[model samples]
Every structure is written in structure tokens, then in C-alpha cells.
Target: MPEANIADRFDLTNWKTESLRMTAFLSPGSPIPQQNWWEEICGSPPEVRSSQPRTGVQQDEGLFGDGNTQGRLILAVQPSRIDWLLTVEVVPTSFELPSVGSFSESANSFAQLMNRWLDVSPNLQRIAFGANLLLPFEDVEQAYQSLPAYFPLNKLDLKNAQDFNYRINRPRNVDYDISDLKINRLSTWSVMTFTAFQFTNVGSYTYSSAPLNVAIRLELDINTSIDFSGELSKDELPKMFAQLVEYAKEIALKGDIL
Candidate 1:
């Protein structure tokens, strides 16, 4: 019989993702009406809302739910910085393997929503968007030991440390801007964080006796100044995001140390 594919053998135990966030900067003189923006983005009046005054600034926030509660949309306005922020997040009900196509579809829908928000608020300056992934590993120690095989000598160093932590900048010709790509390993789990210019995979492992568990968490973020004149197209954003996400998964599942 043929060997199972790398992805099939990984044995993913759990997958969780944080909400997507879009933050728009505003000029000093320009301010957005929190209620209006929430109503517009949510396509109806918000079911819950609140306002509070702190120091010399006012804060307004609204929450919108999709009925069944699978996800939620949040809008927040800060008077001091003149910023408008939107957040949306979703999680699966059961354990499942990662799927790039599903992520692509979700990202595409998010991009479309962001585009709509941009259309309504011309005062919006630069926009930043991001997401996070949490993954649990069963064979944490074996996974950590395998790293040297996938990234050997000159390319990767595993000699001096039991825990791994480092940052990598993108090489030339890369289209996105990634700031501070970091990977850190602890006794129980590993974490990787980077901006969305593109996605790369990094992880660490720890040995624990029975009754102990370990996992890896991946956090991704991307932000860019939007070009309202049409330089940034909706179609391109999701595709780029999809490619970045898919590549990270491939590296985690198939990368070889040798």
C-alpha cells in the first residue's frame, strides 16, 4: 500500500482561530460616528451598544451577532486617536485537519466586507488586518527533535538551545511587508508570530510525561496603507492571504530537516 500523505499523518487535535480585525486610521480633524459605522457594516442596527468617557476622550462600541452565535462582529471608535476598528471571529465545533481552501473562502469574504467598509468611509487612511491560529500537537517531543532534520546546519541551528526562538525577514522580490517574524518554544508549547506579507511555518517541541500535553500556536498579522484610487484590488488580497496560509501549513506538515 502507498504511504499516507504528510498532512494525513500529522494528526491535528484541535484548531482555533481568532477574529479578523481591520483598523483604520483617521486624521485629527476627522471623526467617525460609532453608531452609524456599526449600523452600516452590520447591515442593520446593532443589538447591543455602549459608550464610556475616559479622561478627555469618548469611546463607543457595538456588537452584532449572526443569530446562531457562530461568530460576531464588533465596531469600536476612539475619539482620542480618531480610529475605527472592526473585529470578526469564528471557531469550529469539533476537531479537524486544516484546510487551505476553507480558509481562503473565509478570508475572501472578510476582504469583501473590508472593501465595503472602505467604500463608506473615505476619511479612513491606512488599514491593517490580521488573524491567529492555535494548533495542538500530540507528539510534542518528537516534533521538536524533527526540526533539525528539516532545517539542517547553516540553514538552521539547534545546537545550543532546547527551546527555539528567532526572527526572519523576507528576502528580496517578496510582495508583502513582514515585520518581526518570531518563533518561540517553551516547555509545553511553541508559538510563531509574523505579519501577513506572506506565511511561513515555525514551531517548537517539549517533552512531557503522561498526563501532560503540548501544542503550537500561530499568530499572523498584515497591515498596509490602502490606495483608494484602486491600486489594491479585492480579488488580489484574499489570494495572497490564502497562499501565505497554505504555505505555512505545508512547511509544518511536510518540511524535512535533512
Candidate 2:
């Protein structure tokens, strides 16, 4: 309900989400996914490869769905654990980032996928969910005023400020049936502009019509506060994601991680 409350404030009537990701840290010695899993899970064949350790990228990746309804899903296999970071934006080119259907939609989608992955590799060390929400300003000035008075900006003059960014990270606990879980909540807000290349057909060629979009962005990264020594089952990931979504809405609206 707190997330729904955003439209009522922030001088914005609607909100959009983009680049939503759910991450699962697979436990050590877990089974790596076979090729068939990639085909079945990704909806189509995936671009997977061996670990390029020389490149120094900790997580070797397997990517899926590049276009805008399918979104993006990445398998970042690290030395300690494999991270499943995914989103649902697979479609045509757009001027701006597309919504992940809704805040709750992403939670369900990610949970379902994680559930299936668990069948192949059943142990999880940690879970994380991240999302970027966009709320447009009727006038840019409204954004500055919307900044909470509690922010440590008393000394800095904001009257002439244009581009602004503020972020805070806090630890929070979610009530759980098994045990109350501790997690870290990281929230960041910024006023930003987006630019895209637009083209129109002119005979056999295309003409450029560069377009720009501006809005307020809220980024959330909530994950288990600490890794577990023992393995966690798949049953808890959905609940974890659900709680993460709730906390995200609260922190976004409250403007602080209280």
C-alpha cells in the first residue's frame, strides 16, 4: 500500500519500473545448470560461456532476452556462489526504460523462476532483489522540495540545485515463520535525464530525431544482511522477495529507512 501511495504524492500521477532483478547466491558445491535447463528456463537458447577468469570478472555470465517483454536474465557464476539476476522487459526499442509490469509482478516472476532453478541446485546462501522506479515531476522544482527536510543538506544551498543525488543504507528485519531475517536495505534517489536515438524512414534511409526524457529515479538493493553457514531451502526465497518488496515501498515513501 505504501508503494501505491507514491502516485498520490511526488506531484506524479503514475510510476514506472525498469531493470528489476532478483539475485540468488547458490551454495558452494551446488550443481551447475546443464544446457537443457538453460533452454527450458530462458524460454529460448541462452548465450552461456566458460568462466573467463583472466578478464577478472568475478561472475561468469549467461544472458537471455535482450529486446524490450522478455526483459533480461543473467547467470553470474562466482567462485563462492552463483548469482541469478533477472528482469522481464523483452520487446521493441523504447525511449525510456520499461516497467517490470509492476512492483509485485516482479516479485512473483522472480520467485517462480527461482523455484524452478532450485530443482537443479537446491541450496541457497542468500537472496537479493533490486529495482529501479521512475516518477516524473510536473515541474523539476517540485523534486527539490520533495527532498525530506531531515536530509543533511542544511548547509548546502538547494535553491539553485539542478542535478541531485542522495542515498542511504540501513539494516532491517523481516518477520519470518522460520526466523526473523536480517537484511540490508540500500536506497538511492536521483533527478536524471534520459536520451535516446530516434530514427524515421526517409526513402531507403532513416533520419535521426534524438529524444530526451527526465524523471526521478529510485533504486533499491535489498539483500540478506549476512551469508548463512548452513544452506537455505527454496521455500524461503519467495517470502524473502515479498518482504523485500514491502520494505522497498516503505523506504521509498517514508524517504528514510526507519
Candidate 3:
């Protein structure tokens, strides 16, 4: 095993440039649309939507989870075929174990199991174009980094939304859902709002602070702290939202969120 690089929180550079980023163009023989049939056969989970508020803005939250997720799963898909874009870091060797202890030896076993599941499972890959499963920096350091056994689905949790310092808090409001609204009034804008979801393991055992079955709603009265005097496109907002919704649908059904 190699030593851990504390400077690089997650070894994402090599994996993204080398293996995770790919373009799977649709082909006549691509198995993209049969995802629904596969889901019916295997009974994979479905994707669900929630709302998050930030800086008086509300954005939709796309849910991604393991089969037993508290919320629904979101998928990424295309019409004729589906595609996956994975950005994950390689595990580092000589990683420290969590509170429970080191389970390094179990890494290969889990990988093998997931691979077999994908190969034989009828419902898993049906809706995906291709999937991007990233290994954490710590996991790559040692063969089987015993994080999942103690953490269960913690590995799949997206780190951006959980960490406050991370980009996930770009919008900086608890009730803003990006999928539903567009901040189009600023003609000479200097600052743009960004919202991202982050997560990570801490000194203690990591668990879902919020349940899988969770929803947050926010109401905007259409009164003026800001003026709606600027022209609203009326069309572009929904168009972009529809695209996002569809992508979420594809990921949840295909089991590609990993």
C-alpha cells in the first residue's frame, strides 16, 4: 500500500482525467432504453426529488441512494441510450480506520461483489448509458478500506452538500431549490449564486442526520425585497428544469448513482 497524501483530500485528479470521464455516444445497438423493462424485472429503486433553500432561493434536491435508501434514487439517462459521468477519487493506502477499526481486507471482496451484481443483475444496468463509480483516496491506498461495513451507504453520500466550507453552500440559503427558479433580473451582475451538496466522514460514526424520507419546502410571496421588473424568460426556466428532472429519473432507475 502507498502512503496517504494529506494535501489531496481525495485523489480525484487522476481518476477523472484518466478513467471517470468518458463520452458514450449513442449507437444503433446501444442498450439504453430498455432500462424500464430491466427495472420491472429486478425491482430496483426509483429516484425522488426534494427541495433545499439557500439565500431565499429554492432548488430541487436530486436523491441518490442505495437500494434501501430513505428517499428515492435519481438516475441519469438518454432516449436511445444512457450515459454516466463519474468523478471519484482513488483510495489512498495506509489509511486510518474509523472508530470501529480497519476493515482494509474487505475492500476487494466488496468490489467483486458489486461487479458480479452488475453483471448478473437484470435491473441494475438497464437504464444507464455507462456508470462512473469512483474509489475514494483512502480506499485505493489499502485494498479494502473497511468504511462501508461500518458506514453502510456512507460511501455513496455526496460530500459537497454536507460540508459548509465546500461549494455546496454556494447559494447560502437553507430553502433555495435551483431547479424551480431562475435569478434573471441582474443585468450587470457581479456575483452569481451557486448551490452544491457536500458530505464527509468526521471523528465519529457517520450517519444520515436527516432521514431518507425527508422534504423541505419554502414559500416566496412575490413581494419586493427584489424587483421582478426585469424581463423573465418564462420559458427557459422550465426547459432547463425538465432536462434536470429527466436526468434524475435515469440515474435512480439504473442503479448508476454509485
Best by TM-score: 2
**lDDT per residue (tens digit) for residues 67-140 in model 1:** 22224555666652334333433233322323222233444455566566666664533344554444444545
Tell me the tens digit of each residue's lDDT in model 3 across 11-56. Answer: 2121111111112223334343323422442254333323222322
Q: TM-score of the candidate numbered 2?
A: 0.68
Clashing pairs in 2: 68-89, 68-90, 68-91, 69-89, 69-90, 69-91, 70-90, 71-89, 71-90
Residue 204 in candidate 1 has what lDDT? 33
TM per model? 0.50, 0.68, 0.21
lDDT of 2 by residue, 212-238 (tens): 566678888988866445566567666
In candidate 3, what residue range of length 10 has the lowest lDDT sum? 215-224
Once fitted onto the true fold, the runs of candidate 3 whose alpha carbons sit more than 4 angstroms away are 1-24, 28-34, 37-42, 45-73, 84-258
> Root-mean-square deviation of each candidate, in angstroms?
11.4, 6.2, 19.5
Candidate structures ordered by TM-score, highest first: 2, 1, 3
Ranking under lDDT, best-scoring first? 2, 1, 3
Misplaced by over 4 Å in model 1 are 1-16, 33-35, 53-69, 80-102, 142-154, 157-163, 168-189, 192-214, 225-258
- Predictions in order: lDDT: 0.41, 0.60, 0.23
Candidate 3 structure lDDT: 0.23
Which regions in candidate 2 have their CA more than 4 angstroms from the true location? 1-13, 28-36, 42-44, 47-70, 87-93, 97-104, 147-159, 177-180, 197-211
